[model samples]
Target chain A: MAEVNRQILLVSRPQGAASTDNFKLVETPLAPLADGEVRVRNHYLSLDPYMRGRMNDTKSYAAPQPLNEVMIGGTAGEVVESKNAAFKAGDKVVGMFGWQEFGTSDGKGLQKVDDTHVPLSAYLGPVGMPGATGWYGLNRIIAPKAGETVVVSAASGAVGSVVGQLAKLAGARAVGIAGGAEKCRYVVETLGFDACVDYKAGNLYQDLKAATPTGVDGCFENVGGDGLDATLARMNAFGRIAVCGYIAGYDGVPVPLKHPSLILTQRLLVQGFIITEHLDVWPVALKELGTLVAQKKLHYRESIAHGLENAPEAFLGMLKGRNFGKQLVKLI
Target chain B: MAEVNRQILLVSRPQGAASTDNFKLVETPLAPLADGEVRVRNHYLSLDPYMRGRMNDTKSYAAPQPLNEVMIGGTAGEVVESKNAAFKAGDKVVGMFGWQEFGTSDGKGLQKVDDTHVPLSAYLGPVGMPGATGWYGLNRIIAPKAGETVVVSAASGAVGSVVGQLAKLAGARAVGIAGGAEKCRYVVETLGFDACVDYKAGNLYQDLKAATPTGVDGCFENVGGDGLDATLARMNAFGRIAVCGYIAGYDGVPVPLKHPSLILTQRLLVQGFIITEHLDVWPVALKELGTLVAQKKLHYRESIAHGLENAPEAFLGMLKGRNFGKQLVKLI
Candidate 1:
């Protein structure tokens, strides 16, 4: 293991859209861990929508990543050294290891990974934070019943792909919203959604109306904009909206809600939830999502960018909807 | 008693904002009630923001008022004559009596009222549907804890006024947003809110910041527009917003929400609820709210318009922010 580690830090806050200039690659010497501490060499770093919020220093449910600090992110890695009894050297693990090659932890939140059964990269994609987030939120918040229509945005992404499959697993008719025809096909054909609406299609309203003829009973919202308003217009009475993410407005440009009246008229329940808020459900969520993936009941795709050097470029591409699915950085 | 009854009906569905032409006042002969039916002489008719949704033909939780049909509304009145076992002559009652001087009911939802203690007008204001809506939503949905700051829009109106008071009763500092200084003062001093910001004061952002230094933890939203957007900006992490109404956007004219980005970043919970959805809690809610009003713990104001002919003017005035409090029409 190297004594010096490279990490990605925030160079500056983005005004409208995040760019490569917003990040800086820095090198620092690794320090020995104290009691109950473990050091892990990150193999796979997860890039997600929530990371965009941490880029800003404003107050949020989770503390914002401070300027010049290693940008906080999720990582799957193997323990290189340990002072904690719970973890051993060479054991695969998953934790908030930030955007770094090596991370030191006090073993407070590290979870052991079973790499023998699944690849280590799965921890950053299908069976990790993103997967469990979709599981817990869809199961608990929207709680789609049989015969109900479950609409999900970003349907081919890490979180939303799982949400579509989970809704189908629970016997609900899953309808997905994606940007391109290819992504829409993947969501409908591979993930087995009942229908897929291409939001990039200029006729979003017509597409949504045709897709959800019976109206949406549950909506897992990842993208919010004119599409959000359109979906809201087609929602059934007493519909539940799990506000998991707002990738549509991540551009920092204000998108006016075209149909603010839908909230009241439909008696919609729209709630913004962070998966970390329900950490207690992680064990069960991980086990279930893992089982589904292993059994081939769920399928996922990832756009892997090799090396830490391409992390910023990959992240920028992901934000621009250029990536096909879960965007990940591979560091070996 | 006159054999014929005069009534207001929906002439046409509003494409956007409702106009006086949308409502038609017509006289029709009264039909005698059956053995189970009771005749109610309207005393005070309630005009509320929810009525705006009813004017639209779109599918909503509450069915839209059909064109050429009597306009739906809530009313407090006297049971002038009754053939039902649940009601008697001269008993004051509250019900869905529509926009008319008199109506017949079968006592399915009729609640007999004794106005010997609180005035008859209180039934249409603080101790009635508006009061119950505010109290139930604030306590159950928003659930502001002690020391949390709760902000309410349309704070001098029926529902917002009660919401502010309920928040204050729960030991939270309540701030109100209203149209003018008079309403603001009434919300703060009369309703016991900590402070009230006048949106018409031309410094809404500055006033809101000064009023809620610690930030808004809960918001009882009765108005949706720029006010809702402003409140969204001031919301603290995990703030719960109970969407009681959208008075600001009811007029088919859209006040675009310029900042929906805050919904995701702040982890705000925005739930649009109807009090009637949970009618089982009404008895409990009324009992509690009654105690508050009787003990001088809650205060309410009424803007009563005399005669059923003036109901249209009263409703229009309320829509224009001219009504002082709960706008009501006195039939007798």
Candidate 2:
């Protein structure tokens, strides 16, 4: 068994943009597991935009991460030691294990994972929470018909990538909006989206308009700001917008929507949701995502950092769109 | 039958605000009715805010009013001459007969109205399009539960008056926002809304907050502007907003919504609709509205102009919130 456990703690809250200075890495001695407890050596720690909100002191869908505590996050790792009958040693599992090199649980919230057909790290990304978020927003909220145009922001990220691909599978035209040329290219060529608009191209409105000639019928918005404004301007009458995540405003001031009266004139429907509030759809979403990933029908990429101490930098980088696809820290 | 017919034509589209100068009144000779045609003497011409959008050359939910043609409007009148089997002289009917003292139709679009229990003018306001608009928005879009607070804008106007009353009937708390203290008093005292906030009182946000001690759970918006912004700020988590009309921005620049990211944090569902698109619900809505009005449970007020020549002035006044309740031109 490992004698030392390393963990990252949220020592301070961010006033505006989050910085690594708010976090502190600590080395602590691992104690013997109590009865029915299982100890896991985390292999991958997920770094997502939602973690930024958890760092704030304000109220949100979930409670704020307490000061001087292990930062909350999702993790996929192997069970090094188990006193619980439900989980055996050498078994792969996933749970909210925080930013740590090791985790001890009573086997309540943890779920066993299969790593034969898919890698264990994938349990933290696609075929997991992010994948299910895209599924819920696209199928339940947007529900675009065949031949309709669906626009997705953050098109190369974990959730947005899955959204575009799923929209294409539904026989809808998928148009992506990404930060740069390379990400946009990956969204179109690698992900098989119909078209991609480079939001950094300075002509966001014109570029988005040019891409969606038939006008956007549905939008899965992950990054809100000028991108959302541009998309709003191009929506067709009766368009649906699923507000999944507003990563653009997570760290700074929020971007206001201009011409909100367009919502009245165009008769649009805009809905916002948090996936955690809906646990009932997990079985269905997970089964389909697993089958797609195993069949090679769904593709994904990951930006991984080595060691637990670097998780804060990786998380900050993701907020700036510096990381590609799903951001994770390989703690093993 | 009258030898001369008085008609109003759309002379020009307004650049910003609509005015009487944009309309021209003329006297024309009434042509003899052809076979299957009916000549009707108009009793009331409905002056609604939607006419402002129709006057613009831009595309909207409905087609724009043709230049130099008779201005389009809904009218309730009695048939003076009929060569068609579907109607006879002295039968009261309602149809889109434009802004004219007299109209001749093939009796195809006309619906005979029975004014024995209800007034003929009620067909153009409470028991007609405006009433149905409120019903669809409240029942279908907002869908507030009993004890939930529902906020409505344009509280004393045609559509909003019905929305608050229906919400109260559904056992929900109805709060209204109107332009003046008189309208607010009418909404609370006469319409039986739980409370009404006067938007012109300079403390819109604070007043709205005080009126709704419990956060607003649903909103039926007709006049969008500062009123809508105030409502948005006070919405509860998972709140629903049904966008029916934006009379505030009909003739000028639209008001933008600030802190749109609140939609994400609150997980709100905002939907806009044109009532005409949902014709399948008309029978259900009309039956309920007619029953309520006949039972005296649905109370309404009208501001009537005495002549057809003053129709343009009435419509322009309605656009500026000058006329109270439902604005109409009564041509005897």
Candidate 3:
């Protein structure tokens, strides 16, 4: 059978809001797989805020997407051709690949996804990078003791939703902060959070005060702008804040810290993390999160776009807080 | 001979700059010692920036000083009279006493100051609370690896100066941020800092960049404001920041985080500390810091105001970055 290949290349670095002009879609014939390589036909692509940092030319934890290079993203795909003995054709796997319909990999950094246990999309959501991020931060950094108040921002989003639910499982009072009433209700009723604050409401500070009257002991900081300022104001002494992502400022804008004195006066701990940097810690977190999901103690939702061409729109929507949950683009 | 008892009280909270009006000079006859309390006379009053935080009514890790209460401070004094078995009349002791010419204290929180071994003023500087605060934060929180870049703000002040010297002893690249050329020179030559930036040199960002070209691996943050903004921009990946004090914003004024994205992008660890909260760790720190000071491994400078009446001015000067080194009130 003849092979087909589709590729998406980064055309330019985004100055502010990423536009379609930054990417170029192209079609080419698939090159034959070399020894020790596996060919994958992509099915689902993860759309995450971290990609914004990669779109810049500056040095970061991950290498910047070089000019005219393919935009990097985590992809779940089925092996269509294999020269590597580790993965045969038809094996489902997850790996870091550019925005493309098909990718050729050396099986390095690739994890075999057992599609028989969960839907393929779950590999990019609850049982994937975002969930592992929340788990590791909660366990290793915050170490939430039972009965403590735990606050998580971007509550309806992938990582934070998982974080709130996990805190609940650990017997902590889990509070969530989201952009709208619907997401707030979902976080409280669906994800088992004790309370949810609607940050988009004009009374964000008041709402937060009402939600966490005792002050939060631990915080999963996913959206870090005004919401971070509000959280900083209400944190208890010795509060631990896991600085996972600053989604609010990813567009290259500097957001001011409110009551910056909280960092000093309250004696709070704010630690930053990128899950990949702690990949060595992946097993313990993956095992726990997988068990939680398998036991139905955790839940996930996805707002998936149809194809690779729609990734830019999906990513832009995710940035604007328009996506309902883990934003993914279905490539196949 | 008639025994005299005098006290200093907080008359009014200062709005921007504290003045003599913020204090009330009062004279009261010494109250007869009650059970479980001892009567002692104030000798040397320890003036520090942390006292400014207590003067405010806002909530903090430590309780705020109530209006019209005695101005709180740490002091090294001779126990002229002791009702408790732990002290004697001629014994040199240290306690958390407010700014006063003569005051009484219970034996609690008082440590005998071996004045014969070290100068009495050392109880408030290198071998006392200030030194212990710097030592614990630097050694425990930052834990600079040998040859790592360690940057400290208020580099010639009580805490930061000690932190820099300790970092040097730990074999790290120690850089300091101070307000003047003289202080910066002292930080480099006297305190053994690899480099020192003058925050008052008109171009702080450029100066800081020049001083820490490798980027800061650890930051001992004391004077947080514009200097903090500059420091945040220069942190390397996984940098640790010990927030000892925000002397720059201790007065009721808001200071914003300049670029919060640094926390996320660099995976910085920022933690606040109160020296008293970790009193359990104080002895260990004191032992180490005392050795450093005694052995000339650490050097300290003091700006001693001659009388108790000059404390308000000295404190005001400290807040304005005018006082050199550790500001103290010397009493006969």
- The most accurate candidate by DockQ is 3
Q: List the residue pairs that clash in candidate 3.
A: none
The segments of candidate 3 whose C-alpha lies over 4 angstroms from its true place after superposition are: B34-37
Interface RMSD for candidates 1 onward, in order: 1.6, 1.3, 0.9
Candidate 2 runs further than 4 Å off: none
lDDT of 2 by residue, A267-304 (tens): 99999998998899888998898898899899898999
Most lDDT-accurate candidate: 2
Clashing pairs in 2: none
lDDT of 3 by residue, B133-173 (tens): 99988988999999899999999998888999889888899
Residues A186-219, model 3: lDDT tens digits: 9989898999999888888888989898988998
Instruction: Tell me the spans in candidate 1 whose CA falls farther than 4 Å from its real position.
Output: A1-4, A27-38, A81-86, B14-16, B31-34
Please give the lDDT score at residue B77 for candidate 1: 88
Give the DockQ (2 decimals) of all models. 0.66, 0.75, 0.85
User: Quality of candidate 3's docking, in CAPRI categories?
Assistant: high
What TM-score, computed on C-alpha atoms, does each candidate reach?
0.94, 0.98, 0.97
Chain A fold similarity by TM-score, each prediction: 0.96, 0.98, 0.97
Question: What is the C-alpha lDDT profile of model 2 across B146-176, one tens digit per residue?
Answer: 9999999988999999999999999999999
